[model samples]
Target: MTSRRTFLFKTLPAAGITLALARHVLAADPELAESDPDAMKLAYAADASKVDKTRNPTWATGQRCDTCELFNAPDGGDLGACSLFKGKMVRAAGWCNQYVP
Candidate 1:
């Protein structure tokens, strides 16, 4: 029963609103900081290459969050959610004691 003009007016605004909300919801989460108490305890480094080899003998040269089993990377992006740090994102090149191949 709606006219073409009325439908356009209603649909355009609704579509725009939906797009805005979807973008907000899908926005990337904040990155985890190494200075956090939990991160410090686990020796989490934003860059795997920066991790101290002497302190963590288990760490290998190529280990990283992106390749780790605990990382939940969507679309193979550079940032992802790590099981070690809930609700925060980790860099693809990050490292932590909990990292698994």
Candidate 2:
């Protein structure tokens, strides 16, 4: 019989490998472009500081993808996945109308 400890030990390596592969795949994804149709709708700015505050009154300085609640990039990653834009990557310093504090 496979003991609980034995099972955990056997699965741990595979789990680590999976995590590593996932990270690599994420890293390989292209960064979301500002001109992307969906990106245009949201007014995504690769650099949050570039957002036109005059037009986007609700926007406050310092709001960025990396700081937003939906930001899902791995720690220290400059670009990563976002829940809002499936299969696409957003810049850590980027911003959009959908930003959530």
Candidate 3:
């Protein structure tokens, strides 16, 4: 008969490995950018209020990439989709006073 200690020793490594792999599998996929429009809209709204001096100091001065309603992030980049324009991408580096988040 197998000893309890031996069984635990054999199973512990497997369990640890399984948990590690599960963490990797469950981690957020970097490829899933701008997958949800509603979430992105909310995010934009949240960041919009902040003044981006680097881009624009005032609402009239700066233009947010997402706020322009024409900015769209590329499929795999940190950028987001624009509501006004279609099939175009915007830069995360770009900013405007209209930025929500």
Candidate 4:
């Protein structure tokens, strides 16, 4: 029988690899890649006046990148796959009129 320490050591690497592979597979979808272009444009256009007043009145309100569905910060908190653009990563500081939060 394997010692607890040895079992943990051996399983850790496999677990890590499995997680990495799963993330890679999820990110490889064409839909995620396709969302990048529009998201980038939205991020660039997140100015206070340009954002939808109904969704966001001030830049300090719901204009944060974390609130935008397309914002995909690599830090891995609220970031997720975007449905509008493809391949490119997004920042939490990013904002667009389409921002959900």
Q: Using lDDT, give the best candidate's number.
A: 1
What is candidate 2's lDDT per residue for 1-101, written digit by digit as tens?
99999999999999999999999987776878999998998888899998899877878988999889998877668987788888788999999999899
Instruction: State candidate 3's TM-score.
Output: 0.34
Best by TM-score: 1
In TM-score terms, candidate 4 sits at: 0.35
Q: For all the candidates, what are their Cα RMSDs to the real structure?
A: 3.7, 7.3, 10.8, 8.3
> How does model 2 fare in lDDT?
0.88
- Compare candidates 2 and 3 on lDDT and give the better one: 2
Q: What do the candidate models score in CA lDDT, each in turn?
A: 0.90, 0.88, 0.50, 0.55
Q: For model 2, which pairs clash?
A: none
**Candidate rank order under TM-score:** 1, 2, 4, 3
Model 3 agreement with the true structure over 1-101: per-residue lDDT tens digits: 99999999999999999999999777633322233473354333223446434544455434456445556555545556555324433455454334443
Please provide TM-scores, in order, for all candidate models, with all chains considered together: 0.76, 0.70, 0.34, 0.35
True-structure RMSD for candidate 3: 10.8
Predicted structure 1: lDDT: 0.90
Worst 10 residues of 2 by lDDT: 73-82
